[model samples]
Target: MLSSFFTISLKPVTRPIFLYLLLLAVCTGGTTGELKAADNKALAADRKKVDSLNQLAFDQKRFDVAQALNNLFNAENLAIAGNYQKGLATTLFYEAGIYHQNGYDKKALATYYKSKLIFESLKDTLNMAIVNKEIATSLYASGQSGEAIQLYDESLTVFTKLKDQRQIANINNSLGLVQLDQRKYDIAEASFNKALALSIEIRHQYGEKKAYYNLGLLEEKRNNFARSEEYYLKSLAIDRLMNDKFGAALNHLQLASIHQQQGRSDASITDAKEAYSSAYVVSAYNLMKNASARVIDVYRQKNDILRASEWQDSLVNVLNMQIANEKEYALNFIEVIKNQNAKNTNAEKDLEKQKQVQKEQLLIITVGTFILIIVAVLAVLALVNYQRQRFFGKELKQKNEIIEKNSASLDQLNKEISHQNLLLEEDNKTKNKLLSIISHDLRTPLVNTKGVLNLVNQGMVPPEEADRLLQLLETQYLGTTSLLDNLLFWIKGQMDGKEDDKVKVGLHQLIKVLEEEHRMPLMKKKITLRNLVDRDLAIVTEKEMMRIVCRNLISNAVKFTNENGTIDITSRLGDDHCLYLAVKDNGIGMTKEAIEKVNAKQYYNTTGTSYEKGSGFGLMLCRDLISKAGGELIVESEPGKGSTFTIRMPLS
Candidate 1:
């Protein structure tokens, strides 16, 4: 029967309406059987999420577009999980409506087109027409009237062929509104007349009421006051019977305006009062405000100042109430969201508990089965071993004792050889690294010291500038001494290792010596060094090794520190009863790759912040000595953020 009908030309649905109507008509298209039983858990969760999001969006009354989009996303995911193509198309259509309502015309049209294609493939003509109508309405909202008209004609043709009278009436009324707005009075009048006739034929209450209200608008715009009044009364009566407060409010407000125009102040005031009450019942705040203002105007037009003042006060009260209501509404929305989140959280917690319970049950069953199998196997093994032991236990003990002694001797000899080989390899590496350091770091300091001494001995240095040159010479001498100290100790360990001499060393005393040792060089560079280590905190470690470690850490901090930059030496006692000493500098730091290499104990060489050269052995030697004392070295740095090198040592 749908196919027997012919195509009919009609204008498109008006702007900003497809979204409202699409929301009214859409429902899920796929059956529950589309998903397998095993997939029910996931599908059920996705379905719940979709329903929750959709409800939030609807409850928000199009104010929350994000939630609407989120709902559409989950719906699509559910469709994919069930492999339901029709479900996906329906979901897309709903999502497009949301976008269209939110003024995302391009996105709305694209989404609707995707849904339309899918529906067409499924041979769903009704949905295809529906999607086309949405796209056409969105196009109209986007101001593409020519294309909108074309698509509307096509969609109308489809709906007409399907003999969907209700839909036909809707399209006619919407198109009539568009024609009226365009000021094509004759065309708009004809459209509304057709819609009214069709709506009455099908007894579609909403359509009939809408058509009457629109016809009233058309006749009023044409200055037909009596005719407009008749149309409006018919619409108003229908709205009251249907218990549509918003619709009734609109009709009453319109009737009030018509009465005001006809000079019936008393009747106009009555209708305006009724309209404000109805609008208030529906929480139509804008309508209430408008109706209250209209009532005040009707009294003012009657030249009754006192009555007009009373109505004006009422208008002010209505506005004040609307403001208060808006605030309450916002709070209610927040409460709703909070409640939803709490429910979801509780649901997830219950799911986790159920999963945990199932896991425990499975574990118990598995362990019990394993214990039974183990007991049976052990019983047989024990019986066999007891018989074999009775026959051979005495002979086996004497022979085993002899074989063990020889094996122990051979194992001890192998251990000694492996230990010696490790020492040799370590010694060779130490020698190569020391040579590399001495060639640069040691050589330059020694040469500077020598040159200073020659100048002093020959009296070439002036008396007035002698103190300053002596300070420079002293700095050079101290650096050379520190370098030689590290080389001698490292070499001695490899050649003839001895037990570390542990002593209670005060960090304050130790750091004081270090400060004095590096003071000349620091002064020359104008660098400030602060020692924040506690005076009473004493740590037990090899005295000489600890000194070398502290000296090296401080030296590196100062080396990398730019002129006038500050370095801080601080220490803290740790939970492990260890002392943590930090040498921090406010200067250039390390890049990620450089930090990785340093942490990995790879050979990392870089110039200092002031282009000061380094042997790079300072850090490596510090690491080795700290490890020998059962401590750790931690380096923290980033480019332009400065560095902190921390030494962790056992307490005394």
Candidate 2:
């Protein structure tokens, strides 16, 4: 008993098979969607962990940096296992940053380039451009400013192509700083101005801070301390408001240098101390290094020996701590490798023992199996000979059957050859007939039109006579167009067999249109044409094909019909649900011999009762169109009477 609108579908399967399938689905992700959803969540978690670790390492926090490195290695391993290439590259990049921080510049640069290459292969333009910028900065620090400038130009080109305003501004700002170091003041100013303009246009707050800082450095290089101070303070305000510790630290360091140069010892000392504090907050090592030296200089100028000595000792402590960190990092890496090698040695020993035991057991089993195989081989050989004899007899019978099949095939080949020969003969005749018409029916009209146009162009004819010639040309043109249409249809049908677009078509309406189409021709012959088709007599056939057949029949009738002759059309749907349409003309009829030749498809150009010339393609075309419609043409006529062409097709 089931509710009308509710039904439970039943599947016929055993409970054990169903449970196995369910287990298989869970393992193979055939269950609806949750597998990918879970994978995406895990990937997101992995990415987030990697980003966090990278941030900690960037801040240079000692305790957190070690943990961050461990987490980053784990993330890289996970990314590799998941086949996440981009994530793997990203983790590698951060790992390289950690190496750079530990003062392993060679390893850091190598890893950075490898990650950059990966981004390039992936065609990730944004990440590739960023990695290029970082590589350029490292090169500049290594005193390869020329190579660094080249890489910077490459990155700038990529950023400009991307139209990323913030990245472009950042690249421009960095390029200006490098140019400033190289003492190219004009180029540096131009780069800084471009950065500032772009940053303002896009409202990039951090990029604006970078641009302002670079501009300040440029002015300070030109000995314009007043202008430099204004730019530095403007950048410092933006950095503080945005809480960018690195930006704020750099601004403080630049201000300290400016003050020291201006002979303001007390103010320079205050700025240097503040810059050192900011370095600690943002892991700004270079700023802290410069600030330390600045503090010593300011104290020495004031004759403060104790404060200068203290600042010098602080700088030495920073260098010593870095040396100690690098030593520890190297020792830890060596220990991990030793432990892994020891584990591999133990596993190898266990595997060798297992192999030795398996070898002895395999030897014993092989001897027993070998003895059994020999006896089995003899028995199989005896059986195989018996089967071979039987197979030979069967093969002989199959050979005879195949021979008989070949003989039948050869008979069919002979018949097909004869049919093809007949088709070739008929095709040659058609080509000849087509050439005759193309030369006379086609070219004659064009030549007449050309000659008449020439006469008109030369004003060789009287103006009144020119109008009559034009009328004659128009009639000839219409006739040529009609002939071309028919010829095209004939060629297409020959190349690609006719296809059907079937629909119900009323015979009365179709005949009425055809009668209107040839109304002038009928009037010339003084023929009274009547359409006796019932309005309801519709046929299910291709309309265009059927219409063409009927038009050809009526045209032929009008060609043969004498003056004052009558033509009529009639149609019916029989009880068998098939349509029959008849076109009759009371005119000079075809002789039985002539009709037989036409039925045999041997009709060619011939004159009608009025000696009207034609290609005789109409009757042949009627046969072809009717045959394609899956219908047949039936004819009834005598020499003294008239001809009736009837089309029999299916009714809708």
Q: Which structure among the candidates has the greatest TM-score? A: 1
**lDDT per residue (tens digit) for residues 1-652 in model 2:** 5342122222222344457646754765554377678878887886666566556555543545565566566555556545567876787788777777667788779989988988888889888888888888788878899988999999999888988888888888888988899899999999999999998999988888888888898898899999999999999999889987777878888888889889988888888888888887855566777889889988999999998999999988766765675578667754543553565476557657767877976686566556444544344446658888888989999999999999999999999999999999989989998898888888988999999999999999999999989977865664576567667767767887557578888889999998987776687679999999998777777777777778778878988888999999988777877778899999888788878877777765567676766767777877877776677888788876889988887654
Model 2 Cα RMSD, 1 decimal: 28.2
Total backbone clashes of candidate 2, pairs 3 or more residues apart or in separate chains: 0
Candidate models: Cα lDDT each: 0.79, 0.79
* TM-score of model 2 (CA atoms): 0.44
Clashing pairs in 1: 540-652
In the range 304-360, model 1's lDDT, one tens digit per residue, is 889889878877888888889777755654554455457547755766787899799
Cα misplacement distance, residue 364 of candidate 2 (Å): 25
Q: Can you give the lDDT of residue 147 in candidate 1?
A: 76
- Superposition error at 25 for model 2 (Å): 15
For candidate 1, the per-residue lDDT at 272 reads 92
Residue pairs with backbone overlap in model 2: none
